[model samples]
Target: MTLEKKQPTPTAKPTADDEIDLIALAKTLWDGRRKIMFYLLAGAILGLVFALASPKEYTANTTMIPQTGSSVASKLGGLSSLASLAGVNMSNVGDKESLPPTIYPQIIQSIPFQVELMNTPFKCPDVDQPVSLYDYYIDYKKAGVLENVKKYTLGLPGLLLGVLKGEQEEGALLDSTLASSLISLTEDQDKVVKILNEQISLEINDKEGYISLSSRFNDALLAAQVTRKTQSMLQDYISRYKLDKANEQLKFIEARYAEKKAEFELIQNELAIFRDRNKYITTATASTQLEQLQTQYNLAYTIYSDWAKQLEQAQVQVKENTPFLTIIEPVRVPLEKSKPNRPLILIIWIFLGGIIGTGTVFGQELYNSVKERWSE
Candidate 1:
């Protein structure tokens, strides 16, 4: 007798909610509370270790306002006049000197400028040590031993060294053997220049035509010195270039005026002599010659007068119209460090760590459940 094989009732398909039983998950995690605690403890330790290993950063800030004074009109006019004559329309002619407040920052923060700074001495405060600012930046680029250890622990140790150090020498190796590093300069959409590192931040406020040059460094004295030197460099740039064209123009006008005056005087003297000699000699021919001489003298005198007026205007314009720059408020030494916001950083780190930990725990549990079901 072919007995109809009773089809086994298909196991009730697990619904979406039933697949991940919240009550079961809570029980599983709670039953493995020790394992969970181990993970939490490890995360907390990582946070604490990272917090200690991280370098403290400092920031220095200063505001610059356009200086208000008597020189504005003259400087602005001079720049405009020169540009206008040259067929160049300067956008900020009525405002600050173009070189100082406008073009100077671009020049100063350029690669060549940074290379120049590299050759010069700059002072910066170290983590309980003192260093030249150049060296400070170089050192800041290095991965600290503790930082290396953490990175290795996180499975993201950098190339070259990770293969060399591996897990064995995580925090033991020194970074002094590496080549000296340089600070990177970047500009934002708002045109603010940033020279940054983990330990220091320099934010340049270039909005008011006066650069509010701010920097973060450990040393107050060094911060002040940097700010002052930056300003000086900016001035040096302007003094070298902006005044050159104006001075050249003035010199040219002065020479031309002198030459024109000399010629005018000579023509006047010639006309006077002709009149003195020919006044009483009343021939029709002499009268005609006198009239002709007078006409030439008048023309020469008019030309000379126009030249004289131009010279006066040129001189006034040079004196008044030179785009001048003056520091409104000089940067002061910063008293407080700008970085190492402990609470904020800790909160962020905790949140990130929690997410990673939770993901790992759940991912492992899901994989185990799927494997068991498939095996059955």
Candidate 2:
């Protein structure tokens, strides 16, 4: 009875390998503190240099709302008003656009669109005279220390390849108008386009149904000018596209109307003359001839009237399809630069350097551990 009343002894908890490994890792990092510090310091120094050497860039933005056409319900309401002016029932005509407002961003990305924008003259901070994007970037552009470093380091292979190939003759410059239609581009022109594309961007907000055009450049004035020009060109392009079909229809109808009216007038004059000449003549042939002239005149008059009405409708259609771009936020020259976030860049570099240094330390430790085990 006395032995059964004795309390049972408690078992001791087993030690975890994870806790030991964590302590060992902490010791290893502490031992390699000097190496890690060296890397961190180097990273900070490089970051500082890059931050100082980085070129300042200004960001210019413009937002606009595209008014394609009136709503279908409201469109019919205005048709009556338009019909009174156009002299046709425009109610049956449906609103149409070759490219909708949502496709506007794609239009801006087009090669022809970018090429046109590149050639447009803008004021650059470095130059006294206004220069095109191509001229400024290629001829008058100055490379910063950071740019040179990137060129010599990451882009070294490409640079070597270009050098080995040697310089080639420049391509011929074609007519700007012809180039747009043909989409012809020289090597240098293509290069400039790539650069320009990087500088400009278009963002469309579907929910709000608005567009934002942005341009980033070294010069504040140039950035704003490019953004404004891009917006204007896009709007103009869309308007012209929408008007193309309507305008063509109007021209065709107008031409036919003019032709029919001329025929109608000639027939009317002939009828008048025939009536005057055949007056008091009681012959079956004379009566038949007068009836034929009267019939010809009536047919021509009907055709001419119908064409004239169509001509009016075509004109109204053109006006209806004309797109209106309302400026939600107008482009403005940036007072301060938008890029070269120095502090952020420095932090990133330091963090990257620390990671590399830690990796190096762990790598060395692993190699030594393996070598010692193999030797044993």
Tens digit of per-residue lDDT, candidate 1, span 1-376: 8999898655655654576687778876676566556666676776776676666654555555433333232533444444344344545323433343455456666665554444456555444554444555555446566657766676564555657865443223335444235343322211122343222223345553445665555456776766666656655556555456445556755775686678768878988898888769769998888888787677666656655665676576556643244556667776676656666666666666666666677778889889999999
Maximum-TM-score candidate: 2
Instruction: Tell me the tens digit of each residue's lDDT in model 2 across 1-376.
Output: 4666766544332244667788999999999999999999989998898888888899999998878654232433443453344354444344443466778878887898988888888887769898888888789887788778889999999989999997665434556566666666767788888888789898888898988889999889889999999988988897787677567656755775677678779898999999889889699999889888887777666656666666676678877745468899999999999998999999999998899899999999999999999999
lDDT at 207, model 2:
97
Q: In candidate 1, which residue pairs get closer than 3 Å at backbone N, Cα or C atoms, i.e. clash?
A: 59-216, 60-215, 74-320, 74-321, 75-320, 75-321, 75-322, 78-321, 122-133
Candidate 2 deviant stretches above 4 angstroms: 1-16, 70-98, 166-181, 251-310, 316-323
Candidate 2, pairs of clashing residues = none
Q: What overall lDDT, based on C-alpha atoms, would model 1 receive against the true structure?
A: 0.57
* Model 1 ranges off by over 4 Å: 1-37, 66-97, 115-210, 255-325
Worst 10 residues of 1 by lDDT: 185-194
User: How do the predictions measure up, each by TM-score?
Assistant: 0.58, 0.73
